[model samples]
Target: MFELSRRNFLSQGAAGVSTAMLTSLTRGDAPVSEKKYAVVDEVAFRGQTRRLKLMQGDRYMAALIFPTDYPTHFRLKPELYPVCTPSGVPVTDTHQYCFIHHQSIMTGHGKVHVDGTDHAVDFYRQLPYPNTERIDKFHKTHNLFQMGPSGIQKIVKADWKVTDQIQLRLILDWQLRDKESSGGKSVISEQRRYKLFQRGPYTIIDQFTQLSPHSQSLTLKADRHSLMGVRVNDLIDPDDGGMMHDSEKRKNPDGNYWDISGNRKAPRWIDCTGRIGNQTAGIALFSHPNNTRNEFYSRGWGLMILSPTLGHDVRVTKDKPLQFAARFVAHDGALAGKTADELSDEFAAVDYRKMFETEK
Candidate 1:
């Protein structure tokens, strides 16, 4: 059994910085010194998918990757994986033994079309399948990440810009284009925002994606593959030892119920937890207001996502992008000691629009 580390990572850095740099380099009144500053390091991957690691006080906090395959130009999945506890135990799991389709911590899926070809891709998995609704990548979408006052951001030359910054909460903003979707060319644009932060031992991630058709229109067919989610470690999966709770106060006995809620009156959130290492660790997924789809999808054996596009076919043009938004919270720990309603109350208090202006 592994003993969990409860060290406070935010307290380990050097303190007392120059009044000038503090004001010039950080967000709000966060007295950041040289030691507490976050850093990013890019490393090599075996293929086109490059990896970038984020650090604070020089300790590993998270990693982002661009999962791209060359020969097929499909499966261009982007992810933030292996999120760790203060003591360094990876709280999230990937690369599983059973469902093999779970190699992601936070990933996105949408079927893009051009000339009647099916480009609905799932960058999350790398396998041949009966689950054949999978393919990956964009014609010219390049992903990038960097460290700043807003936190870590992912950029794609000019087509995509994502900022994962910290204010009262960590806020993520993404602005991108539908590169080469219409007859093999960039035609549409999308903007997204996410806010995440940690409270006690829980980490909360909230996201919103907006669309603009520019001059051409984009279509999103109703399917079970969309939104960001996680695949829990086997130790905490229902088939192994975990339990799942939904807003209806109902429990899913196991993972076979992945997205069962999507087929019915979906709940507001789902909570899953079990013994991680030697401590009781888990994840609770929350759905917020204004989402396009009324249902949420959840599976046992550790998989959860917000299927905002389920059964709702969408046609996006420059004038009609605000018709939808997929917003959810991925929180670490099973309320630890609080109730789902209490957690929901806390999530409700976050307002990412009140962000700080980046230092010039």
Candidate 2:
């Protein structure tokens, strides 16, 4: 055997070690795995009284304690319409107008305004002109800044389960109260409907549902002699403006009255895109049968708006409680249609007796 020199042996060892280190460095950083859930507890926002908690689990998620207080300086402002898209692009600019009330969650703190007020108006104000009278005149009837009943109680959770396919469930408790108007001739009925929104790796999804069964279905019934506004492609022509004046009316002449074009009236229903976990989701709105104007819908890719007017006429009747119910769901395109249909069925099955049961 040939003997190796001390310097030769040391130099060879050093070279081998350097090569190994270089190889390791060139491999880059290790990949990070996605978390199954995320939890946000007691997140204090600018204008809210209650401490909000958000939880994300493997198959279930929740938002607890939504605030009911509103601030006095609140003014409605414009916000981006159709906040989400099936193409996975979010609307970043506000092009539409809605009320923005202010409030603080915890007491003794100066009032802080939040965007949730604007969101609430944008999400709900979609009825056609004549039908949308109530919401348009909301301020004249009641103070926007005062604290109302707690809309959401305890834990509000949404769950998703995967079998051969994916399924979703939303659970919550809500309250309703009637506030006397200054005129005393009429009363403004307050109903707190639950709103749900989800944004993930896929696209965007927004949905709303009534937490109580006491809510009425969305239905419409105008006076017998009252004119039933002509619908041109998902819009109602309250003014009877001919199709030549409106482009949307020209597109779908045979569509429902609520679908007509040139009709500035808010829509009864809306369909928009929602995103989740590298998948695009579809969102739809449904109403209960007891509603006066049976609900109608607007289907599209970005945001869907459902009008409260679509459920009933806004004539204030003393002691006649105005009831409403709604449901929202997020699903892949494949299940959007089926999910919407099922939600409609569920709304129809709701009864007054079932509405009062305490949720477990």
Candidate 3:
């Protein structure tokens, strides 16, 4: 059987794992038969809620938490929480008083136009009109925090498959709140998928998102908050000695990351590396070249986002949906720029269609 040692895995990184796997398949060699990791359901908080945990051997590596508590779960969005390094230190955070809506890793849109309507919906904030405007301008870091939004993501159907990777497939209804009626209106149908696998010293998370109008046409307006987002641990935030780097070789040393170089050019990847206790860990968010390619939202305050519709409006119909994919490489150290580029190139070369095609 093919076996990879921890030392070799750490030395070569995830790219080497791909090469090894492909070589093993090509040479008809024995596979890595040992099941080193697994995805399982975990009950927590006195069994009030359940979550999906990615377990490496007997340790926790990551989790998909469905928040059911007050306020945070009001938005009805599940969060990827407690993303940990190989050594078992969490690199992600959630439910911070500063930004209660923020998740370790999440997805949402700010301004969504249904059937080309004049009013834009703020799914990102999940807040209604006036509240959304109020919260946008309110920046007192120490003041009382309010529930950002009320828009709900209703899970219509969900399925999970485990192979070399653990994949979670969800069909969700993006709904808007109605004052007179309950359960909101389903405006958009979303197909969101997450695949988690181990690649050498990195825990790779590949996200695939597809959105279509429920029954009418929909337009995703160019809003700053629309797309996939991640929030690193506060201890790793740039404000707290962490470092943010992008494909343009720009680093955020001063709290101001509005350089817009990578955002405007749509860099292949952006990352943040920092020390937690005695371990140095990092997370690199990679954009596929085949994506719509728009501005990236990078912040020094522990937030990184991929915005595909930030520059222009994207229209979608029931038949024609808007789709995109991204890869999150969470490793136990800073990744070199060359390695980041290589990983980005490898992700760009993936046959996403075949990998995510509807199984027959």
Candidate closest to the true structure, highest TM-score: 3
Best by lDDT: 3
Give per-model TM-scores.
0.63, 0.37, 0.79
The lDDT-based order of candidates, best leading, equals 3, 1, 2
Q: Which ten residues in a row have the lowest lDDT in candidate 3?
A: 253-262
lDDT by residue for model 2 (218-303), tens: 11222111111101111111112111111122221232334333454323333333222233333333445555443232222122
Q: Cα miss at 311, model 2 (Å)? A: 9.8
Question: What would the per-residue lDDT of candidate 1 be over residues 102-214, giving only the tens digit for each residue?
Answer: 55456444443323443443323343333324334433342111100011122343122223432111222231223323222343344444444434354444555554554
Candidate 3 regions exceeding 4 Å error are 1-35, 43-48, 67-75, 116-118, 126-149, 253-264, 354-357
Which of 1 and 3 is ahead in lDDT? 3
lDDT of each: 0.47, 0.29, 0.70
- Which candidate model has the greater lDDT, 2 or 3? 3
Model 1 segments more than 4 A misplaced:
1-37, 45-49, 70-75, 98-101, 113-188, 253-263, 322-333, 336-338, 349-360
lDDT of 1 at 340: 70
Query: Compared with the true structure, what per-residue lDDT tens digits does model 3 show for residues 1-360?
Result: 999764344334433433443455478643333446677887765656668887766556688876442443343567788786554556777756576667788888877888746566666654532332344345666211244335666666767887777788888888876666567778888888888877666778888888888888988888667688788877677887889888888786322233345444556688988876446778888888667664577777788888677667888886668878888888777789999998888888876654445642
